[model samples]
Target chain A: MNNDILATLSITDATRKLATKEISSLDLVRACRANIERRNATLNAYLEVFDDVEAQAIAADTRRAMGEKQKLLGIPLAVKDNILIEGRRASSASKILEDYIAPYDATAIKKLKDAGAVFLGRTNMDEFAMGGSTENSAYGPTKNPHDESRVPGGSSGGSAAALASGMALGALGSDTGGSVREPASFCGVVGLKPTYGAISRSGLMAMGSSLDQIGPLTRTVADAKLLFEAMRGQDPLDSTSLDPSFYKEGLQRKKIGVPRHLLARGVDADVLKLFEETLKRLQEKGYALVDIELPSAGLALAIYYILMPAEASTNLARFDGVRYGLSRRGESLFDDYACTRGEGFGPEVRRRIMLGTYVLSAGYYDAYYGKATQARRTLSRECAAALKEVDVIMTPTTPSPAFLIGEKSDPLSMYLTDIFTVTANLTGNPALAVPMGEVKRTKINLPASIQLTAAHGGEATLFSIGREIEAV
Target chain B: MYYDAMVSKEEVRALAQLARLRVSDSEIEGLQKDISNILEYVGQVGSIVPNKGETQVLRAQNVMREDILYGPATGLINKGKELLTAFPKREGDYAVVRKIIHKDE
Candidate 1:
């Protein structure tokens, strides 16, 4: 295959070629680097392309030559800036840690490397994974590959864009709310937020540690399943990591749940039209579709905003200049500490920190943070109840497709992008965003993603149904 | 939810200080006005009547593990030390900072 074709092949396809000795890991890495050089300017997907990718590729080739039996042996992948790859800068695209390099590999990165996966480079994200649009990054917003002016939905914008533009066959993304799925939908790729604790978060930057999850954004559902299996399992480093039992069962049912009432509000007309047609198409494929009601689903975004920011505020307190990372000096010790944080963090981050701090503060904690957590319990219960009735929950990943970068100047409007995807996060349920189809006119092909959420450890069901729907 | 409930520029400055973010005086005024406006929208959550005391807060069930040495955390502390050393300012074995408390502890 030529360089573009090689770069575009999913991880499974690339690995099969490598295992058969048809194409070397070196060729794949070089092709990807070349594609990055040619396309990254327009896509702005990557903040830094590794100068040492060839070396890693050579290492993978050496391992394969020695008869290594790993499935991902010789596959190339991208790590989002938020994921640590020992001794590399894992900046989450912020000035706060611009010069800070990670000392250890994240559990997911370590597993992938052990499986002989070659590291491409770190992709960009909204600073601290704070915004719905990539525009919050201090480095500048990542443009959608489909349209230059529109944003590739964010926090994971660079990861989704890199995969779409062929910089890497697959990339890992961290989703606190809908960071991964929203961007995947906007870019027309597959993104999975495996059930909470499904993938280890030991080396991933803490952004709302309770809600954060690490998963893959790839071109196909099979590829997502491949990466998810490779990186998932129990990790001692992350106390919250789930056992392998969560992924044992696969989706075999012909029945699926479609939540029409939940998805009806705020959904753009074109987006809803495409979503309804997708359901019709699935119905025609011999699948039983049941319209279900998730009563607490509408409150997902509201609950997420309350709980995530509360966790984020406490988690980010460690970046105080007294420890490692960036800092600014002043005449007095207090002045130095204050100035460093004052300048280091961006506005949205500061806003969240303040809101989080206030909610968790002594007086109002009972009213805000306490109440949000209670609602989250109800949300999780609702998900469990819905899953008992069907194999998967289907909905549009985002209410709309990629919007213009500056279209949502108001912060609340920008936050609405996560409305559909947050319920999965709130419920700690595994969900996948599979591209359904496109809309008319606008250069944007409205990628309607049906969210397939299985009960905890229900990845098999998700993948089986995702494969079926995607095949259609 | 109008100017009557408006967060004043003075309060914004105090909030900025409390949060360790620097806001210019003019910026504080703008933020005070802007944040108050934004809160007015999000304030709808206040009207939501949550069930009485049934919701249990999600807490990390702390699990203590055996003191086992592993490869992943192996080089972590050393790397942290190295990065701390590289920071522009530091006192022996620590990243030096302006004392946070103005008064003696």
Candidate 2:
């Protein structure tokens, strides 16, 4: 295989190559390392590239030579720093845990290692996965590979960028809101946010635990399927994990739902045109398109902000600089607690934490946090009803294509980028972002994407339809 | 509605304290202006009217399984130490903890 192919090849192709001994694991890891060195300077995608990756690749090759048949043998992948890899810093891109090394491997990391995937390095992200863009990352923002001046949509921006720029064959990203999908759309790569409890969150830095899920970012639909099939399953440690039966035997290209009303508003003309064209192509390819309306879609952003921040405030409260990370010296206990957090967390993280604290505070709880939960219930019900009619709901992943770097200083505008994708997260539905060719006429190179959302335990439909859509 | 944009400087300070964030007076001024703008935008959510129905609570109850607790997982400190070793600062056996708690003497 060519070096470029080794670097950018999807998981399925790489696996076939490895199985056939067409390209050795050493070649893939070395190509990935070279790609990282070439692009990461501008992209700022990785927090660290493990120097010992070649050694790990060698070990995987040794195992392959020994006749071990694992699904991910000899594949190379990047990991988000939030997920623990033993002896690696799981910073979560937050200064509070800047020094904290994982005592043990995250269950998913352990599983991937067991499957024989080589760890390339860790990708950067928003501190504790707080911000919509990676601007809140303690390390620095991961720039979009398409245009270095623009943001690679965040908290999984680095992972998406790595996949988009051919730095890694595929990478792992966590979705708590639109972290994975939004970035994938920005970078024009495939990203999946599986059902909330589909993958274990044992070592992932908690950020709204209910909404947080680790998913895959890859070059193609089948590549995503390969990684998903490998990483998914119930883990004994995570109580929220369901039995592994939910994701099995997916159907091939079938009827897909298009929520015209939900996707019609606030979307750019070019993006909307691209979305309609995607539908047309899918229809031509024999996939049935059904018109569906989901009114709860408008309320998704509001509900997510409320619920996600509330959980985040609680989840982030554990990092007081008492255990690890940057701590400030103080005369008294209160000063120690206050000073450390005040100095450690960035402005965006502090803002969300404050907002979360406000919503969950007394008197206003019933009005804000409580009511948001009720809205979430209604949203879940609406989505469930909608899914019953259509196997998968499709929409533009983002309202518009990636904007210029430093274009959106306003938080509201930044949050709106997730408008199309966040609902799936709020309702715990599985969603995937797949590129649907480029938009016409701008030097911007706007890549349009269609989001495929499946019902709870409907990842099978997602993967099957994704495979079909990709083939076309 | 315009008055919503006119946030008081004192209110911003109080909110910061309530959120346990330390802020300088200069930062508070900027925050007051920005937060006022944000609240004005976020206020759009107030338009949402839910039906008169029993509210569904999604409170995260402790999800600990009924497994036997063999006490805290031991030797995790060594792992924690390996992680903390990368930090620029160090004290002793314990990762030099900030004075976050007070014991009654």
Candidate 3:
């Protein structure tokens, strides 16, 4: 089979071939590398394509010969810069940790290693996963694979781009806010952010401690389930990790709730048209679509921005000059810290840290952080109320298709893009982004996606619905 | 009660100091403007009346695990030397730090 065909094959297809000994892990790795060699330079998807990948594949082949048959045994995967894979450099796309090598594997990475999956390299991301675009990466921005001029929606932009461009069969990305799903929507792939605590976050760089989740960016919903299941489970290291029985799997209700009020103003007409068509398709298939109201839904982005940055500010305080990575000294201890952090973190990161500090400070805590937390509880309850009526809630993953690399110059406008996706993070509900169809922009058919959010512990529902959407 | 929706230059500097960051003069204006705009947008959360003194019950519970000295936390994941290797200024296994406490001259 052609290398292009081999590289482009989905995990489901690749695993079957690997199981039957029809394809070697070397073939899969080399096939992925061939495309990476061709496109990575321009796409800037991978920060580094590990030189030892071929050796890893050879070892996997040896294991297969011994009657070991793990589905991910030889599957090559792209890991986001934030996930630690022991001994490998995990930068979180920040200059401060650029030279820092991981001391231990993230729980997710360990699980994948147990499954015998091969790591391609750490893909680029927004520094500290702060921005919605990979442009915030200290190294550089990751362009959308579809159109070079547009950005792959970000934070997990590189992982999404890698999967879309056939650089990897599957990829892992961490989502806080819309990091995973937004990019997945932009790149026309499948991304899942499981219910909070569903996946252990040990060894993943801390961003918004409360909001951060390691997710899979893949070509198909089935591929995501395979990766998610492999990575999900309780970990003693990450106390928040949930047990398998924590979230019960319920029968598909075939009901999707649409919060029309939130979508009425901001969503692009063409994007809404595709969303409506997807709803109509599901309705024709005997799924019921009910209009639901989440009164606090509109405030989700506001609450998320407040809460995430507040958590990030504290999480980032550990990056003082003494411990690791880039450390700079100054006249006094205070000067040492201020100078090191000032020079270390990117502008967006600094901006967020400052925002977080302001919110958590004495006078403003009640007005900002305090109110946001209260509102977050309200939002969660509202989502729960809505979920009680319907199995899942639906929305356009992003307001529009992928935008030009530098299109959103203003920070507020860039944040407005996340309006539709932050609700799930706030509510602790599992959400999936699957490409619905394409919407044309400037003579290019950029992909638009539909986001389905299921109740807490409702990942199975999202996957089943996601597969149904994939069929559309 | 600062409701003007504008973070002043002095306020930005104070916040930067509190956060242990230094904002250059040129960047401060832009950063402050951006911060204020975000504050104004997110400030709407204040308007949400929380059920007239209803208690906010967070679903998060304390996750306690047995403190196994050689468990995954310390044994499986933690490698002392590998962690020390990341330190920029280390003396053997100890991370080197400046003397923050200075005796009166």
In terms of lDDT, the poorest run of 10 residues in model 1 chain A is A439-448
Task: Name the docking class for model 3.
Answer: medium
lDDT of 3 by residue, A153-225 (tens): 9999999999999999999999899999999999999999999999998888998888889999999999999
Better of 1 and 3 by lDDT: 3
What TM-score would every model get versus the actual structure? 0.94, 0.92, 0.98
lDDT of 3: 0.90
The order by descending DockQ is 3, 1, 2
For every candidate, C-alpha RMSD to the true structure in Å: 2.6, 3.0, 1.3
Proportion of native contacts present in model 1: 0.35
- Which is better, 2 or 3, measured by TM-score? 3
Q: Write the per-residue lDDT of candidate 2 for residues A1-472, one digit (tens) a residue.
A: 6778789887888888888888888999988888888889888999999989999999988898899879899898999989999887788888777777777877788889878899999998888887667878989888988777778888898898888888888899999888888888888998899998888888888988889999999888888878887888887677787788766456544778887887646898989988888888889978898888777678788778778878998888876665667778667766676778888888878777777776777845766677678778777878898888778999988888777767888776787788887888888899999887777435668677889999888887887777766776
Q: Alpha carbon lDDT of residue A419, candidate 1? A: 86
Instruction: Assign candidate 2 its CAPRI class.
Output: acceptable
> lDDT by residue for model 1 over A1-472, one digit each (tens)?
7998898898888888887899999988888889898989888899988888898889888988998868787777887899999878888888888888787889899889877788888998999999888889988889988887889998999999998888888999999898999899989999999999989999899988878999899999999999998999898888899877656566666788988887656888888887788778878988888988887777677677777878887788788776666777766765675678778888788777766766666765666666667777777777898888888888888888888889998777888788888888888898899998776436546455667778888888888888877887
For all candidates, the clash counts are: 8, 1, 0
Q: Candidate 3 at residue A341, lDDT?
A: 95
Off by over 4 Å in 1: A444-446, B1-6, B47-53, B67-83, B86-88, B99-105
Among all candidates shown, the one with the greatest lDDT: 3
